[model samples]
Target chain A: MLAFQAGNLGAFQALFAKYQKKIIQFCHRFCGDQAMAEELAQEVFLNIYRGAAGYRPKARFSTWLFQIAVNVCLNEMRKEKYRHRIDSMDASPETESGKPRIKELCDPAPDQNELLEQQEREMMIQKALMGLPEKQRLALSLRVLNGFSYQEIGTQIRCSESAVKTLIHRGRQHLKELLENLYAGGDKS
Target chain B: MTCPYETWISAFMDGELTPQRADAMADHLAGCHGCKAKYEALTGLDQLLQSLPELKPSEQFERTFWKKVADWEENRSRRRLADWFKRGWRTVLAGSLALFILVFVSVFQGRFTRSLSPEEIILAEQMDVLQQYELINNLEILENWEAIAGEDESS
Candidate 1:
């Protein structure tokens, strides 16, 4: 980033090459939409490029990068279009044809049953993750998904390290309970 | 029953505790089944999250991003050009108006203070003499004013 700030544009390409996948995955987990994740990731990089002139190396580059990513995701979710989408998702797991989306998403494949099971489990985990309150979800994702420390998560989320710890703990507990309920419901049906 | 040490267990699982506190929590967890269960649950949850599949961008993601960047740069340049044009015209208009006002005021002032023509200069220099001549010509009329009024009444 500093090199890019010094007019070495190739340095920026190198940075992009290194962090692109991580950033995409982060957005994917945040919004639960792959296409939107790519879009948000592009926006994140655009902001970074535009803000390069003001880039200060006070914090780690990845920390600064993820900070922008988090803001972009939050802003997108705050938009009326995405807010409606999230509202529909919250209204029910199935918003189409009155069918369970989990089953609909998991089509049976004789050869890929294991892959199907893995995809199903991932979907359930993502749904539970989305069920968390925004702050908790952000804190947890920064910590668990991005492997940021409590201090880094606090910096990203604008809270105390202790508060971040508490958020992550509560987020984990909530996720556990949500998963349990989902599994129990699945078992019953 | 819930354990008070569950939060510590969560932090412990994350290796967030200080060494001394971590050791103490580890010892406590050995005897405390509930807190240990909480730790296990949190661990399982973390692992499950870590195991979530990685999502990759489409192959043309970089190409698309660079294209967007080019578009953004072009738009910004065009905006800067437009702003420069707008400001330039505004300044030019203001300057022209000021020059016009200055020219108009100077010309109006010059009309009053301009070098006098020969005829007007003579008129200005002899203006007191001209006034004296006019008074002399009207002296008779001024002196017979009462008699003239009486004659007109009789007629």
Candidate 2:
């Protein structure tokens, strides 16, 4: 950032090259739309570029980056508050296992049934996450999806670390209730 | 809600609980099926969230973003340049106005002062004796005016 402040354009590019994917991923998970997330990510970089001169090395650059990203996302979500589109879970995963999935899942290329099941579960989770209030959703996504520590999540969200833990806990409890209502044979609810 | 350590179950799922607290929670879960179910549900959600795919932007994301940044910087510089010009022009105009007012006031200050001051009035009276400046300036031409007019008439 100081390099960019010192007029090294390549430093700006280097920052973008290093963080574009992570930033886009964070925005996508926060907003749940690739195109909108891409736009938000662009806005974030523009903000960073505009504010480069004022950039103090307060925390990790990544943490600061996420702070800007989260602020931009919150603004975008405020503007689009009523436009949320829930990913429909018409085929919420039909699993008989007591646990959701024990082992970590990574499929380079899954068969069709596995793909369909995975897609359904992903959609259901997205829908559940959408039902959450924006702050809770952001906290939960940062913690669970992005794997940010509570302190870092607090930094991005402008709350205490303990508050972050509370947000995540409440967010997860709320999401579990939603998912269980949808998939745990309490579908009648 | 059924167990006292339910919050610990959440903290434990994230590996956030201290060892002593974690041991206590593990003991609670072992004796209580309901709390264990709650723990499973919480961890299940965590697992599902972690398993969700890491998303990526479109392939042109980098190119488009860099291009936008360049455009933004260009526009910002242009704006700064324009603002500099705006402020520069304003200062120039203000300076000119101040100078004009000063010159205007100065040109008339002696006249105004002579009206009210004894020294200026005496200086003005002494100077007013040489009032026909233009006549004195054209004295040589005026002395030969009759001869010049006669020559023109003859031509």
Candidate 3:
């Protein structure tokens, strides 16, 4: 980052190559939408590039990067357009009926049952994730999905380390219950 | 059923606990079924999260990003140029106006002084003193008048 800040384009490219996929994945896990994830990732990198001159190494570069990523994700989630998308997913027929909406599922041929099942499970998981409170969802994703330590997650989310632990603990419990309820509802149907 | 050790189980899994506490937790988990079950469920949840499918950027991601950067650079340069031009124009306008005012004031002063006789210039220069000339001339007399009045009163 210092190198990039000093007018080294190669350094910026190296940083981009190293973190592009990670940022995309983090955003994707945070939002549960691939397109939106890509958009947010671009915005994150653009912000980094634009603000490179002002960059200081107060924290680990990854921590700083993920802090920006988390902020971008949170801001994107707050937008009415993205909020409506999440709400629509929450009210989608698959979630309500506990059965994969035919139109929403992969090709429903018997040969594709495994694929269909996988897609359905993934969908359910995404919905279960979206159902979590914003802080829990952010904390849990930072830990389990993005693989940041509790302290790193705390710094990114602006909470104490103990608070992060509690958030993740509750987040995990909430996620488990949500997934179980989703699967149980599916089983009943 | 909520277990007091539930959050401890999470911390223990994440290795955030001290070794002594971790050992105690392990021993407790070994003897307790409820906490053990909760631990397993949490472990599965972690696995589920880890199993989320990985996504990659499309091939055009880099190209698109660079194009955006280029466009941003161009726009920024243009804006800066415009700002500089605006400042330069303003300075030029201000300088010209100041020069014009200076020239006009000097020229007006020279013309007026030339048009005036030497006596008129002196009168103009001392206009404030001249306006109070009568009062200033009588000031000493006025000061003594109070003393004369006092003498007359004594008499």
The segments of candidate 2 whose C-alpha lies over 4 angstroms from its true place after superposition are A81-109, A184-189, B90-155
TM-score rank, highest first?
Answer: 1, 3, 2
B-chain TM-score for every candidate: 0.54, 0.52, 0.53
Clashes of each: 0, 0, 0
Q: What is the DockQ score, from 0 to 1, of model 1?
A: 0.30
Residue A85 in candidate 1, Cα distance off native in Å: 3.1
DockQ of every predicted complex: 0.30, 0.30, 0.29
lDDT of 3 at B106: 97
Minimal lDDT window, size 10, model 3 chain B? B52-61
Q: Candidate 3: give the TM-score of chain A.
A: 0.86
Please tell me which predicted candidate would have the highest DockQ against the true structure: 1
Residue pairs with clashing backbones, model 1: none
Interface RMSD of 2: 4.1
lDDT by residue for model 1 over A68-185, one digit each (tens)? Answer: 9989988998898776665665455442446443442433534466766776687788788888998899988988888899998888878899999999999999999999998888
lDDT of 3 by residue, B39-143 (tens): 998998899778765665766677888988999999999999999897889889999999999999999999877777899889899999989989998899888
lDDT of 3 by residue, A1-189 (tens): 999999999999999999998998888777876657778898999999999998999989998999999899889887988987676765553423354444333433344666567667778888898889989998888888777899999999999999999999989989899999999999999
lDDT of 1: 0.84
